[model samples]
Target: MAILFRRVALVQLAPRLGDVEYNLNLIEHGVQRARAQSAELVVFPELAVTGYFLKDMVSTVALRIDGPEVARLASLSRGLELIVGAVEESEDYRFFNSALYFRDGELTYIHRKVYLPTYGLFDEARYLARGDRIRCFSSALGRTAILICEDLWHPSTAYIAALDGAVALVCPSSSPLRGISEGKDHDDNAAYWELLNAVYAQTFGVFVVYVNRVGFEDGVGFWGGSEIVSPVGNRLAKAKYYEEDFVVADLSLKEPRRQRVQAPLLRDENLDLTIRELQRIQRCRGTLGHQECGESHADCEGETDAGLEER
Candidate 1:
């Protein structure tokens, strides 16, 4: 018997800066429309509840994970799973860039953004605390992991999630349009994301669902090129750039299994060797040519360092 395919919707919207109520209403409307279209899962862009580019307003608009607003979002997720991003406030008052997963009117999982981009036009580390964990969770759509914006830029996050048995990786991004390509066809940022999504999907044999926001905020315009990549690195569906879009595509759960059977990269990974090599590299840090272990460079020649070549 063939596995049944599930419909998923990617909602690309431009949220009002610092206006939590308005953004929530937009999310509610998107969820309603996705449900009307019989979608089993709906994904929103990063910081969909509170618009991105909140320099100082991040603290002012940070919300508790169990607050009334989140409760309202959970309520809207009846019969369908929803993945949305927002500013999460901890009990100690520290804020984190987070993604919330809701299913059957309940909060299923929460993935806090681990990597906070602090360079260039980004200042996330100034306002948000970093998340220390990256793990996948069971969802209505199957085993999945959530990586917010810059978190997906780090290869280890996705690798770890795949190692932890994730079949789908959902990413919510608020990437701005900065550099244009030489051909003037697509923004360089969008092109990079396309390559990144395809590489991760193909290498890990997992579905990649990326949703990005659109519109201008504080002179920076977000490029909305939300897309879904199949386990074999096929671009299943993509939303239009610079516009609010509701894109849906059917994803086959059996694709990952088929791809993994053909590739088997994860099954062949050597985790023990990886961990040992990373430990050796961590111990090699030193100043003025002095090794931490007091060993000379010549002494390390015989050691098999688990570098990129090992993969």
Candidate 2:
């Protein structure tokens, strides 16, 4: 059998806060390094063009999809695939945390972060509008999807990508390190992320490429434990901790193909059942219960599964 493979590179770098030009230069250097390694694709950290934690300066470094900044990013693609995160400014004057996918020197796909975390140190909901669409597009390395930061935390995001026929899930994150682990030098969050990535990889039978940033911004530090996990839950490559590192890995299409034949999880997923349950759950909540139930709120609360089946 022929070995179907793609050499992938993950650049875990510290982006300069709110500096598009400087960050672009950093990305260019990464792309150059990737080309030297003969990588087919290079993935960068989230908001790589504009640093994270931009409260009111969201629009200051925002780039329109057709802008010169994006063109520069596109040019970096050249003969390879490039996934770079940036602040996208729409025509209606809204800014989004977006991942731009470039292949063969053209803009191919764009994924705007859907789940914007609002709690704790995250105030994204206050500064940016939420995205509603999640899609997988054609790429040099088969079908792929880019899920940014908090979007990967939601199981539905990865599920949708898997069902959409994505073989590779690329997640570009700007995650901040929370709570020190005494003498360990890394936080508890690292362990949680490793478990989460492995679960998604094995469960969905797809490769997981996670590229995270390093360095401190406004006193908060981001851990740079970037990694790539194979379809069978094996770590292909991992970057350095608390420092910038360029990680390279070989992703074989054979793994996903072999796993699907062994597991067939995605093939067996019941989409209709999931939709029905979601709609039923939606009707069981708040005003939806009173209106969508076609009966009294109390009656809806006391409804049985048999009654729902009849409806």
Candidate 3:
């Protein structure tokens, strides 16, 4: 059985970092336009609410889970399902890179980013704490898991989310693609990411939608090639790079179940065995120096599996 939906709109937003009012207006306008097209679900890039490169102002603009920004989003999403990224501030003053899911005028779930990338233009570790668990949120479409950029690069996170019964995974990213990524003989960085998304989609046998921001923020330019992939690891629809646009595609969640049943990758092995294999490989690299064999594992810094470019 292949379960198919009519349409999902992935909106590529080019937001100037630190501009809250402007970003909000864009969101509202984007929603109206998406509604005009009769899209069932509308998704925005990571940090679409307040912008991505917060620099030192991350704490200033960070909002509580039930703060006014979220409330406004809830109000704006009266007739549609929306996923937008924001900086979340806890009661204890801790902060997180978070994604909020709203459906039919109600705030449904908050997914805090688990892997914080501290290297290469990102200083997330300085601003946010990491999430401890990976699970799926209940949605009208089905059970779906949310992974902010870096989470998709780690196989364990996706595997655990799938084990937790996620039918699909949504990744919101601010991909820092600086140069041209077109033409036949482009750079490997672009190809690497395309492969990364394909791997997760194929391995888990689930639909994956990755939304990325466009335009340059501060000094870092975000590459806006938001894309959707089917369970068979084929790219279904992709938005243009360096352009603010929306791409819609019809997805079938039921087809993943059929593919998994035929492949039987999930039923064939145990997680412990897979972990052991990964550990063996890690030991070969002398990378197990930090000690991750136990429940309370060490920090996941240093060569963290090229977690999907949001870092």
- The predicted structure with the larger lDDT, 2 or 3, is 2
Off by over 4 Å in 3: 1-3, 178-187, 272-311
- Candidate 3, residues 97-126, lDDT tens digits: the string is 888899989888888999988888888888
Local distance difference test, candidate 3: 0.80
Predicted candidate 1 versus true structure: per-residue lDDT over 1-311, tens digit per residue: 97869899999999999999999999999999999999999999999999998988998888887789999999999999999999999999989999999998999788999999999999999989999999888875588999999999999999999999999999999999989767766698989999999999999999999999998998889889999999988899899988999999999889999999999999999999999877766665433155444555643442435465686
lDDT of each: 0.91, 0.90, 0.80
- Candidate 1, which segments miss by more than 4 Å at Cα? 286-311
Best by TM-score: 1
Ranked by lDDT from best down, the candidates are 1, 2, 3
**What does candidate 1 score on TM?**
0.93
Instruction: Using lDDT as the measure, name the better of candidate 1 and candidate 2.
Output: 1
Q: What is the lDDT of candidate 1?
A: 0.91
**What ranges in model 2 sit over 4 Å off?**
182-185, 287-311
Q: How many Å off is the CA of 73 in candidate 2?
A: 1.0
Question: lDDT (0-100) at residue 14 of candidate 2?
Answer: 97
lDDT of model 2, residue 125: 88
Candidate 3 TM-score over all chains jointly: 0.85
